[model samples]
Target: MGEDADVATSLADSVSEEIADRLAPVDAELARRYPGEPPTRQPVHTVYVPADAVSSGTVSAWGEQAREMLDEHAPDAVSFASVLGLPSHLAGPVHDRVRAKLEREPVEDLRIDFEDGYGRRPDSEEDAAAARAARLVADAFEDGSAPPCMGIRMKCMEADVRDRGIRTLDIFLTGLVDAGGLPGGLVLTLPKVSHPEQVAAMARLCGEFETARGLPEGRIGFEIQIETTQSILGPDGRATVALMIDAAGGRATSLHYGTFDYSAACGVSAEYQAMDHPVADHAKAVMQAAAAGTGVRLSDGSTNIVPSGRREQVHDAWRHHHALVRRSLARAYYQGWDMHPGHLPTRYAAVYAFYREGMERAAARLAAYTGNAGGDAAVMDEPATARALSNYLLRGLDCGALSSGEVARHSGLTRADLDALAGRATEAQVNSGP
Candidate 1:
């Protein structure tokens, strides 16, 4: 009986090896297609200013305006909480953090819009604006006043504007390269991408720019704006967004939904168009699924309702924006578009509240899973859940929702430890073993 069991075990081992050998190509393909999430800090919001309106002080000015709005409308935590219907426990902390965030880093990502925001001008004028944008961006970085990410959203690759878009991009890249090289946080967005072919063209343009400027290959990456119905569903009745990602050839950094354009494309009236509309939700759901595990982040679209005018009007807009932002966060879309300065306060408030509300619970779960604390028998977390918990904490730390000390104290793990657990360790950290 012992000899028979040994023979069966040997046969099982051989079968396993044969299967593995046959699946080697599949393994390689999976790794290539699904490289997992990136370990970078994704900003909570992206603020878009027209190309002509983007001055060096644009970023700081937005912060100041948001601060003033808070001071005037919601002078204290109590009022702010009343306006937003925030819980008493969260009101004080969220209000204080929002103010601090506005003072410190009001805008994490800024995009100079040359598309819908800045309507088409004469060739010479557009060229000058693109060059000026490049110079101002370079100066911002040199003066250490630039946002963590800054770039331009050029026009789409439609037949009529294709050459113009290519020219603008060329001018912008050239100007940046001439201005003592590109900033490390340089971001480029290709707006109104309706087809995978457009995405491929953008990728090819990036490659050509890299070669012309003597920069490293794959140095320039752009976000694909998913604004059209065709982008979500191709003529062939398949998911076109997934094909668009493939067309990008690994140069697509994010997929940003265009709330109004997408809704309009779906035949929704202007009054009904919004970030939380059913059409908007469908588009983003498709985007989220296609971008999953591809190292491509997802960003929700913006609300056209700018918080301006009377105090009551401002509060109403704030409430609307805050709810939408929170809804997006809850749906795992951590980033969105902020069209006006007033959006800043609510943006941070929503982001901070989302992270802080769950901070302790996430830390405890992570600690238990990592063996730093006794396991909670009621909820046995698997490795995937642990990864999610660790990432949640890391994101909180990244966006100032939680401090490093607080995370360490609660989780019994430092930032480095969290990074390791979240699979975000740098190559250097991996090589320098503990």
Candidate 2:
């Protein structure tokens, strides 16, 4: 008994010491990152850009369009769809042009697709080329012209497709590191992730590879697409989704709605069940339920509408799409897909609208938190209020609706706290909008 007690005491002491050591660096880093009690709002915002947007012939055109789009929509951050946009062409010049185009704009973050777009299969040469592209892009960024944040999206985890998926990831990532193209983060776009076992395997693979290569072990993160019937409806679907993320060992940062695939999985024959479709609601619920309290961002699927040449119609489409995107933005999803260049405005409008609405709500909650008569301390716990407010705020930040100074005025909380709370509230989107 004495021996056991001594062992337990030793374990506890070691844990405490380890925690203190880890926290020491964290505290210092936070201090350097924000010298003072930062404002309760974040100046940084993230927006999604598609891979197809900046392909070979389209790089300059897309870049020019992006500048215009940013001028109009004013996104805080933007991610390009990829260096792999050139496909099997594999020349260094293709990558250089992409890099040049990317360098022309300043963005908060960038996401590069290591695998071929939307498809899980990749040939060996293709995979090898992707790794090279990643390396080149990283080096370009290091030359001080690229975005500070970077992420890579690899293949998904479908059982039948697991072998190809693993190979694609292994080759691409190994090449990435070997070529000195290690990104700030790794994003695995897990498609049809029906069970926790797949997530566990992915975690283990990342851990093993990172360790072997002397990189940050398990530093690789994931973003899953809840786009299948099996994923959405397990023997118990919602629970499975939650467990899969847990099995991922806290590495998942986002859960996206894959509209087309999900609709197909649900046996919905209709070809055009847009974001407003009832089927999409079910998909959204699955993603939201899984994301709650997980500290992961939730994103709605893309708007598939192809923009026609009419400016009035395009503007009208923007308004209509913006309202719907705002609805999702209000629901605490900070990001949504832009299927077309014209859809850019809709994305920004949604983000901006969300931020403006969130600021007002957050101010009210802070007031209530200070003066509420309810004895339940939980009454002061306005998660729903915070979620609504923060979602809007983040949307605004992303879309340039709220300026850094304005964000500072609305929330007295520090930036880190504000970011953490806002991200958390969005993840725990329990509020039905009070």
Best-fitting candidate, scored by TM-score: 1
Question: Each prediction's TM-score against the native?
Answer: 0.95, 0.67
Candidate 1 C-alpha lDDT tens digits along 1-434: 76556542436678999999999999999998987777678888899999998899998899999999999999999999899988899999999999999999999999998999999899999999999999989999999999999999999999999898999999999999998998878999998888999999999999999999899888899999999999999989999999999999999999999999999999999999999889888898999999988989999999989999999999999999999999999999999999889999999988888999998888888778778864344567988888888888888888888899888777888987887787775656534644
lDDT of 2 by residue, 240-341 (tens): 677776777866666777777778777777666677778888768767766665456677776666545564555456566666676775565656655554
How accurate locally, in lDDT, is each candidate? 0.90, 0.55
Question: Residue 378, candidate 2: how far off, in angstroms?
Answer: 18
lDDT computed for candidate 1? 0.90
Among these predicted structures, which one has the highest lDDT? 1
Q: Cα deviation in Å at residue 392, candidate 1?
A: 1.3
